[model samples]
Target: MFSSKIVTFNKINFLNKLSDGFKITNKSHREYFNLGHPLESPPTLRGSMVVEFKMSFILDNEEFFEYGSPVDIGGLSAGYIGLENYKASDLKVNFFDFDKIISEISAVRFYERQKFLEHEITESVYGILKSNFNNDLADFIRFDENPHSRLFEFCLAGGYKINEDHVQKIHIPNTYKNSLLMKRISDRFKGRVLTFNPKYGFESRNVG
Candidate 1:
């Protein structure tokens, strides 16, 4: 089974919020990341600029399988609202191969969401994603589901560079290509490829 996580950033107020509300059962952990010196190790550094909320979700194998089913969210059953405070800004997302660090941070949110949704797990998750990411780029979004794993996929445009402020412009590599397994959006704007870890959820601003 797969897990999910959502991270939000109120760029205006500079507030960060992370939630693991998309799990199979309801066992998740949410906390704030301390970017202070010593603690600024690997994981912390990767997530440094974040200030305020840090959350997580975790689920066991049995519970995960039971609630990881997929549901369609096209019409009424869909609980998505359009993006809030829509702004012309840049966003980036990154997909990682299963590793210990990724698994641990992601597991917290994955399990938490499962527990939150005693039922209606799939539909609820779909709604949340649609509401949060439904922009001019919605068509670029994708998902992966398997008995043992699951993943959320998407692409970003608009000159956003990795490890830089959203306002800065970056050039995309000319080698970028589109495929069934992966899609590329290359134009005058900077394009980035992103995939979310179904288990760990998402990170605000750090989507690259």
Candidate 2:
């Protein structure tokens, strides 16, 4: 049962998705700095960005939730509609490991689909990756499942430096090498490299 999925949408877009019945299980701050990124610059400074998080578009429509992004959106996204809890906050302050701050802020939760049989979690998760990020930068963020620890394996992996809104360019990280889950699109990446926590793309969220 996939309780939640990773997503990237601003508050306005998020509200629209919610109008379509997408419930937010949790969310990550749209502001983040990739590892090795100078701590002096965070995400918020770049204005006109979207809100990204873990979400599930299922209330009574589980089918809508499952085969939508990969099948319907057609590689426009990746990752399971997972969960995270990040309240409204200011995206300033720099020169520190944001992993610590994000960890402190996120109280992740999943809005799983009803599971009838016991399927291997890895395949399902991996499948989502392949469906969503088959051709893109799948080698970037490979931290989805490690099998031992059950938590949101949030890592600043591979992403793009899109120049949107003209505020400046942004580093939008993909989830992994298999799936560039549009799960999280942060304005943070002024870049992605370096691991403050030693383990960058090794763990995963055990949603069982």
Candidate 3:
């Protein structure tokens, strides 16, 4: 049901092409993913925005077949609705998978060490992996939150590459790293929640 192809992972070259605001078609086992416009129908993309379909094969499961690429890393799944019925974080007990919710909160975004060459552009699946928690419910909407930093970090680490945590500490761009600092100043204010929104050309405006 998806068009699959093998492509090289070039950090700057790729992101330069992927300007911003793209849709992903995979959730679990994100091995085969499609990037394209939100309005396009699947299977047959007429003027498909699908940038490319890539498979980062593993050489006998030991190393990535592609020089600096790694196997597909998974992302957080949007939980089903009717969550009020879930009582607690119990794997067998909670149908909502509450225990997994805790893991989602603490999940660390790391990558395979062997796939990268100590210092090379990697991938932004880290942010994808980090969507378990975010500034907004992007999983439900399937939107990328830290595109600016994702782009910046992609330059430093290259797409998804980073210095192994053991080798060098990660230096996140100020946009994402200090994003929470504003909340410190924000908690002081209590305002009405936005309840009305109107769709505009590409972008939306809060008409409430």
Q: Which numbered prediction scores highest in lDDT against the true structure?
A: 1
Tell me how far the alpha carbon of residue 129 in candidate 2 is from the true structure, in angstroms, after superposition.
Answer: 18
RMSD of 1: 19.5
Residue 170, candidate 1: Cα error in Å is 38
Cα displacement (Å) at residue 168, model 2:
35
> Ranking by lDDT, best first?
1, 2, 3
lDDT, candidate 3, residue 66? 14
Best by TM-score: 2
Evaluate residue 186 in candidate 2 and report its C-alpha lDDT on the 0 to 100 scale. 27
lDDT of 3 by residue, 75-140 (tens): 111332222232212112121232243233234334422111111223343343344333232232
lDDT of each: 0.25, 0.24, 0.22
**lDDT (tens digit, per residue) of candidate 1 on 1-208:** 2222222322211121111112222223222111111111113222222221111222111122211111221211232323233322222222222122234323445654553222222444444444544533332222322211112212212221222112122111222223221231222123333333323322323346
Q: After superposition, how far is residue 203 of candidate 1 from its true place, in Å?
A: 24
Better lDDT candidate (1, 3)? 1
What lDDT does candidate 2 reach at residue 102? 29
TM-score of candidate 1 to 2 decimals = 0.17
